[model samples]
Target: MHYDGVDYDAGMVIGAELKNGKVSTQIGFSVQTFIVYNPANGKMELMFIIKNGQVFLRTIFIDKGTIEELLIGSVIQSKNYQAGNTGFKIDGETGIAEFNRLVINKDFKIIGDASKIVLDNTGLAVYSTSGGVIKLSRRP
Candidate 1:
């Protein structure tokens, strides 16, 4: 799969699982973190995984020095699924942390949804939503 314009080589197949009568494949890899600018949420550093042709957002981190203080220590997880022909959705949440003195608590809720996915065989996946368009292109 592609992320931040880079196409990573397929790592070792970890395993597979049956879901809804279809086997989903899993692969694993490691790389330095990267950032994605979301029109709805600004910039976030993220790590992702792909299974069953679907992309899963595994982690989100904001450095302590970032300007967005409200998002400090925030974490996000999401999964992308095919909606229909040329369409898709990303359903997930961001765990928001509330700090009071020495106490901290996290609250998370469903957060993102992207529709109208246009896939380009030439190595591009375009996601269009009300906020704006996010184009993910593969590396050569």
Candidate 2:
């Protein structure tokens, strides 16, 4: 995963690793794009508001046991494709994974402790603790 100034090999990169806890989504005037974790269901979710002021469900996954064992799928509603599809899976416990961008260029990144996550929605009572970067590449 490569973003800003971080470059992670795609082959060994494991997707977001959310602990079993409720996570929050970023909020702001502009499109609030961030990777969140839902502790209630023990799943990680990517939250984003599109350019047209539309909120859509992006990527979701459940941490299996190891980093490589995690499974995730994306629910995207785009002009080209509008539907939920199974996403790629990481093959290693820890290495480098590509940023699962929501849109074509809107990449979300989180990086820190092996288990340090930022709180998104307070009402949801979600907490995140992991370290990884998300790079959003704007589409032309």
Residue-level lDDT of model 2, residues 1-140, one tens digit each, is 67899865422222444457855444343223433445566655445434455445665464665565534453222233312222222323333232222222125333322221111222111122233433334345
Candidate 1 TM-score to native: 0.17
Off by over 4 Å in 2: 1-36, 46-52, 58-140
lDDT of each structure? 0.42, 0.34
Which 10-residue span in candidate 1 carries the lowest summed lDDT? Answer: 96-105
Residue 69, model 1: lDDT of 41
| Residue pairs in candidate 1 whose N, alpha carbon or C atoms collide under 3 angstroms | none
Q: Single out the weakest 10-residue window by summed lDDT for candidate 2.
A: 117-126
